[model samples]
Target: QTYKFRLYPNKKQEEQLLWTLEKCRLVYNDMLAGLNKEEKPNRLKLQSMLPELKKQYPELKGVYSKVLQYEVYKLFSNLKGLGELKKKGRKVGRLRFKGKGWFKTFTYNQSGFKLIDTNKRLKSLHLSKIGDNISIRVHRKIDGNIKQITIKKHCSGKWYANMVTERNNKKHDKKISSVIGIDKGIKYFLTDTEGRRIENSQFLKNSLKKLRREQRRLSRKKKKSSNYNKQRIKVARVHEQITNHRIDFLHKLSRSYIDNYDMIAVENLNIKNLVRNHHLARSISDVSWSAFDNMLSYKAENANKTVVRVDPKGTSQEYKYGRDLDRDYNASLNILERGLASLPQGLRKVTPVEIEPLQKLETISASLIIETGSLFQNHK
Candidate 1:
């Protein structure tokens, strides 16, 4: 698990951190250049080149050794990511060199960083080369063994320390009692099998007016001017605010469901294909169904609950229900039916309640005619 905390670096430490980031960026670009020349790019070979690189560019010695090496790892990591995307038939472009402010993070892998607990409100994060007194706000208790620290500078001009840790997760061993199936939608965030509807907050839509205002102000500024940079940060902050609101909403909603239900059933949607529809793409993206599903899965696992992903092929349309039935609620029932079918006999407790049939003859007749026509055509 990774936990992020705000870093309040003193002026001198901030400058040093920025300098280290710049050096890492240069090193990344340099390694990429070298990799391009090589017939077969090797990780160790690229890492070994760092010493020679430091000798060539003596300014690199100012940064910690492990931090510099991680830059090499980061470059290869990007290459690997592109390779994976290409394997999946994505048209990936080559890695581009990091421009001035484009490079925002540098990591201390395995060592060279320490978190100091002063028994006070504000703690200190000590880095090997940067300094020891960089104040860190430990809002929550750090739970596991710390593995590495990644220092990141956000576009909003705020610094954060992301500490990656590892610990064994103990599954919740309590008996399963409650189960639910949720149908995700743009209109309502989700509709559960119990007929509960959580309204979509539409955070991006709400912030777009202020976002546009900041973006327009940014565009009017001269290129690379002081005002332009200042306005850029303003634009970034608006986007950041929208993101924070959405994440907070998702976290709370997912948490509530996890706390209440022992088993959750969600559609295993192919979101990439769903977004192909240009009209509904914006709405689909705004709802962030995939993120919510992921949250439920991980949270359920940690809580020893079950998260079942039923096939999404016909959840919205295949169910036989009356026209008066809420489409989302109907879909939720279908999802629940599929979820119950997929579970073990022992885990299955409550049987799904049957929806009262108020079938339309016209719909049944039309479907029968289509099926009969297809069969007749095949026979002929």
Candidate 2:
């Protein structure tokens, strides 16, 4: 679970990366549409269709369909999983869009694209217009052989490539090197059973001054003007910096803990309650509580250790109020009618952030997961 999130492009390189995404989208959509109209669409059909489809969309055909070509077929195979779900006719609010601060993108091997560094050369990928062997800056030397590379432009105008690699998890075959319990809290990131404390990164605190200043600058810019666009990029950069700093800080620190003791215990936090306060919304999101849990799970499992999260019921990690240790799992009364009325209206409006791309589930290689209890409970 030692996944690295690195920013890998200089400006000129990033510009062309956008072309790769556009080319991929065009090819993917074309193939998808073509497959939809077929009586029996199969691999050879897709392989044959590429040249014709590209001939029609000369722009896509020009890029030289290599890996992008195979993926079109692979995507068709994967689509079988979703075909049933689509029968319910779910809402699709918008057609897909890629490029700056937008969707995640992939281009295949036949395209002249590859990630690069001062030292090592990664696998070459080619897309139509972008040519083959497009260079990628290797921000850090990766651990495993590169498997797949996806170039993404964040909503913040920052360029990033997520490369997935398969690597042996670090071994931590130490005897219960040490046992520790953790109390997770806002004031303290983690307080262990052995009384060791890890501070909250609080990256937002250090960033707020600059963030507010840049945001204020953005506010003063005339709307939709060159100046405003310029200010928007500036704002995006500030947010990007904050994000990078937080993620880097978390990854390093979590690895540090994993590299140490075995049998690490922690209090299972109720984050929904914490997020109720609007003032803490940004900070909580910045903390990425779910991400932390995800990290701890993978890191511990890969290292052959136990990560036990105890009930928060009698926890006293971050507070000095209300019964000294009891976490009051309070509930507000709601009539039966109110509960039933809330179903369609309230639930439908609550849009959950799409989690389809979370590597946490897919990356856990031979890891053990132990669940203490459910977050949502109903009493009789």
Candidate 3:
């Protein structure tokens, strides 16, 4: 698990952090330049060049050793990512050197970092090169051994520290009981098999007026001027606000479902392909279906629950009854049926109820709709 905390670095410490980031970027570019010249690039050879690099450029010696080495690892990781894309027949580009202000993060891997918990609410993160006593606000207690700490500077001029940790998770033997299938949409955030609906909180859409005003103000400023930089941060703040609101809503909604259900079934949507449709792209992005699915998966694993992804094909189009069923509700039922079918025979405890008469299913659906409407009204 990774825990992110707000960092409050002093002016001198902030300058040190920025200097380290720039130094790491330079090292990354230097290694890339060397790799391009060589017929066969070796990781070890590139790493060994660091000591010599410090001799040539003595400023690097001021930065932490492992922190500089991580830049090499990051370079190869990018190369591997590009290779995977090329294997899938996608157009790939070579890694380019980072320009000024482009690099915003630096990592202290395995060593050169310490977390000191004061008796007070605030903690301090100590780095090797950067000064100690950098106040950190850890909202929640961090469990497990910390593997690394990555310091990042946001476009909004905020600093954050992400602590990656390692821990052995105990396996949970939970009996499959409550089950649900959810169909995601633009109108409602989701509709479940039981006809419950959660309204979509269009954070980006709601803030577009303010965002447009900020952008217009930014556009009026001269490029690379002090005013331009200040206005740029104002625009970034609006985007940051939208992101935080969306994430908070998703966290609460996903947590509610996880707390109530044992198994959750959802459509395995190819979000990248769906976003290609220009008309629906904005709505789809606003809904953030992929982010919600990811939260459910991770949270379920921690709780020893189950999350199943069923093929979305014909889910909305196929209906059993002669009368028209709600598209999202029908899709959710199909999803639930498919989810149960995919489970092992012994584990498949609850099967979809088979209602022969159309009138009975319609009545149940109507009643559920009314119940959900009341709940939404109360929530509002």
| Clashes per candidate, residues 3 or more apart or on different chains | 0, 17, 0
lDDT of each: 0.82, 0.54, 0.84
> Which 10-residue window of candidate 3 scores lowest in summed lDDT?
357-366
State candidate 3's TM-score: 0.91
Which residue runs of candidate 1 sit more than 4 Å off their true CA positions? 172-174, 320-323, 353-380
Q: What are the per-residue Cα lDDT tens digits for candidate 3 across 239-335?
A: 9999987877777677777877889999999999999999999999998999999999988887888999999999888786444777778788888
Off by over 4 Å in 3: 354-380
Q: List the candidates' TM-scores in order.
A: 0.88, 0.62, 0.91
RMSD (Cα, Å) for all candidates, in order, is 10.6, 13.5, 4.2
For lDDT, the strongest prediction is 3
Q: Residue-wise lDDT of candidate 2 within 150-259, one digit each (tens)?
A: 55677666555566667776664344434434445555555443333445667777789999999999999999799998899899888888777666556555665576
* Candidate 1, 1-380: lDDT as tens digits: 77889999988899999999999999999999998888889989999988899999999889999998888888889899999999999999988988988899999999998899898889989999889979999998777789999999999999999999877887544555678788888877787766566667787887889999999999899999999999999999998898877777776677777877888889999999999999999888888899888888877876788899999887878756555767888888788778877887666566665433322211112122233432122222
The residue ranges of model 2 lying beyond 4 angstroms of the native Cα positions read 1-15, 28-51, 64-104, 107-141, 155-158, 168-174, 222-224, 269-280, 311-380
How well does candidate 1 match the true structure in TM-score terms? Answer: 0.88
Candidate with maximal TM-score: 3
Model 2 clash count equals 17
Q: Please rank every candidate by TM-score, starting with the best.
A: 3, 1, 2
